[model samples]
Target: MEIKEHIIQGVRIAELHSDNMLLGSVEEAVDLLGNMYYNQADAMVLYTEHIADAFFDLKTKVAGEILQKFSNYRMKLAIVGDFKQVSSKSLQDFIRESNKGRLIYFAETLEEALAQLVR
Candidate 1:
């Protein structure tokens, strides 16, 4: 697992990269958010290209766990990249509704994701 911080539009966002499933449960998601918060990040952009391949079947459950975890902490999360390749319609709907509320967004581009986070 690797984490890097980057500032976009004056908002600090952390990018997390993992070769394996790093967020298998709500507890792990909460811990990740806690770390980002402590690191002064306004949001997080998860790069899941590699991990997705390993845990393709757990995407929905993982996404739900992450959303639930961040909702509890009131933290923002943005998943950046081409989700069309891995996301199902159900997951897409979940993403859309989650974005409509607040704190969670699934973006095709990092720039768009950052824009949402800074708002």
Candidate 2:
């Protein structure tokens, strides 16, 4: 995993770049969060391609579990992806609702995610 740091509006954000899945399981999610927290990153930006497909499946409950950890740690997260391709209404609703908050967001691009996180 290569983390590119960005400071926007006095907030430190970490943009994760990895060829493999970053949040494939709860363990990996916690590990990634720990790494970012130790690096003093207030927010994180990650591409959906780096996340496990299970995360997009609402039935698996992986998204809720992992996202709860992010909330518990008080770390903001922005997932950038082409969500239009997701056919699940529940997942689409989840993304839409998450985007309405400051803690977590579902964005279509890196720039959008960064802007959302900074807000």
lDDT of 2 by residue, 1-119 (tens): 89999999999999999888898788998999999989999999999889999999999999999999999998999999899898989998999899898799998988898899988
The best candidate in terms of lDDT: 2
Pairs that collide in candidate 2 are: none
lDDT of 1 by residue, 7-113 (tens): 87788888788777666566677778778888888888875563344223544566565567788887788777677775567656666786786698878887787
* Model 1 stretches with alpha carbons more than 4 Å out: 50-62
lDDT comparing candidate 2 with the true structure: 0.92
| Least well predicted 10-residue stretch by lDDT in candidate 2 | 18-27
> What overall lDDT goes with each candidate model?
0.72, 0.92
Task: Output the number of the TM-score-best candidate.
Answer: 2
